[model samples]
Target: MDSVLARALIEDPTEDGRLPLFLLFLAFLATFLITRTITRLIRAGKGPFRDRVAGGVHIHHAIPGIVLTIAGAFTSVAVDGSSPGAEIAAVLIGIGASLVLDEFALLLRLQDVYWEREGQLSVQVVSLTIAGLGLMAIGIDPLSDHTLSVGHLVIAINLPFHVAGVLMCVAKGKYSTASVGAFIPPVAWIGAIRLARPHSAWAKRHYSSEKRERAADRAHRFDDRYGRWGLNIEDLVAGKPTASPAVSGQEPSDPKGAA
Candidate 1:
């Protein structure tokens, strides 16, 4: 017999029409964890893995990630949703997306900031992406769940309002909320109604000095209460920055040019 997890994921999915997404979430999460482990080991000079270098250029994993993402996305779009081809495409997309997000900071900076303090952005981005995927896999879609009714129709019709909530949260510098709000309408609505971060565009452009001070106070309090836990989690998942990590002078991984 298969294990309990297998039974839940493959045999008896918790939600209707979400098995493909569940598979994708699992694939993405597993791929990201494994890739981060290898990269961290390479950075610490503790494992067999090393950076990838071409004839003379360094090769980043994002290149192949981009290829796989495009190929899988097109295949997923082309294939029947319930078919095995769609499942394969979903897994490919998940793997490719994880690989790309694992070095998100590097892409934004256009350099190997993978082992620097700025590398934390990669972890943050990957975490948000995973959270969004996990929510979707668990059936937290943006609108109605395919059930047809007046209320469902209204909710679906108000999709633009929900989207605005997501954008509002982003503008207010509530990224964690924005990540959830993108999938769950109520969460975004709440974030949109909350106080904007003091340094955010919304706060800068709209808030009075007194209101900004209050926002800053609240932001700091929240950070002081929760930032340590977040940092610890990030470090645990992606490894902490070293004084002089391998990316300082070394190259990317996958020497056979598979990176």
Candidate 2:
């Protein structure tokens, strides 16, 4: 796999790098297949072990992306044998640009479930699309084949659609603002790992914090909205009214001011 990817990156079969590039596309194909499988299991209410494993699989998707990038870097160095000034500059610039896109991709993806649960379709679409494009682009090997480069650029180009989708979500006034704020870290890490580029400590910390905060906020909101509905206080009350407001209004009042 590595050898094929390395070859694809360093050389183009045709003069122009047209895609369905074999090496780059397979990664995305894998991501989508795994994502689909896990989502199906989750929806079908599969066993607890499957659920746990799915969660782990979900997290590891990002790691493959990082690995692909590292592979590209090494491939470039190996192919060129020495750094040409232009190639070196291009690598740096590409990393910087890609990091920004990566951050937005993960940020939106994390909020997708929240959006779905809240019945915010617009936000869900935006989040899913951004993540999808990012995941797709990661599958495309941009380091090779200049002709196929435009296909790689397609991911970045379509980013505005995601931005518009996010704006629509904010306009709807349905999103939890706190959750949006908590979403910043993973997105920021996308940028951080690409530029200034420290991967392990910061990425882990940010991802963990975002996950914890979102989970806590979701539970808090769920309880706030539904906790009272399941209460059994009525059974414990000695003489509380058990009828509608209209029925209580028609009932005779106590002679005294007391019930």
Candidate 3:
């Protein structure tokens, strides 16, 4: 296995330094899965591990994640080439990223809200990260590679087309689509031409009352159609969200209160 890996890293002419990136993805996935398992077990009160507290203050895993991320980033910058050192640095960075992203809700909300609905943000972010990395692993290079074969003049002429597509997708509030479309132009075109989501700024600015109603209806139908699938995926990845206790007959208030 080591020999095969070494050959792929060193002898493959088509690698283009992607081996380290592939390793990074593997490391990130492993680290994230392990971290999620441990956290879920802790939440269920079934793990040998317990939350770490020092001097009456709980220590969140994000602290170590931040340290590892900084260390790995600096190490990668200082390392000069696509050697084993670079691979190790990539692994460190991946692990750190997984740890940090696992607690993304804490960072975003500035509080501990793991196991709550808001915690689903972490799962979403991780899922997107995994998809992006997987795409890269499969040789999808975003915008930068699109003009590789074209002459400079042709690239210059085509640049506006790509830029317009990207902008249109963004304006429609399809950020994930825009990101993928930046790499693959057809995706961007589709996103650009699609109706804006009801709450998107584009809808607010350009949609007439009737158009807004239509957009709203589309958004509602979409949510109704796919929301359950999304929830299932989130639960599979990050464990099921724990609901807060209701007060009287009303749904529980937001744990963090209204901002």
Model 2, 76-174: lDDT tens digits are 566553335324433433343233223332444453221122222222233343354334333444444354555556535544554443333233221
TM-score: which is higher, 2 or 3?
3
Query: Judged by lDDT relative to the true structure, which candidate is superior, 1 or 3?
Result: 1
Sort by lDDT, top down from the best: 1, 3, 2
User: What are the Cα lDDT values of the candidates?
Assistant: 0.69, 0.35, 0.67
What tens-digit string does per-residue lDDT give for candidate 1 at 6-125?
A: 433454443466777888899999998899888878877897898899898888989888988898999998986857878889898999999998888799879787876445556656
- Output the better candidate (2/3) by lDDT: 3
Question: Lowest summed lDDT over 10 consecutive residues: which window, candidate 3?
Answer: 250-259
TM-score, candidate 1, is 0.62
For candidate 2, give the lDDT: 0.35
Task: In model 3, state the lDDT of residue 245.
Answer: 28
The list of candidate 1 runs beyond 4 A from truth reads: 1-11, 14-17, 148-230, 243-259
Please state every model's RMSD to the true fold in angstroms: 9.0, 19.7, 8.0
Count of backbone clashes for each model?
Answer: 4, 3, 0
Residue 20 accuracy (lDDT) in model 1: 77
lDDT of 3: 0.67
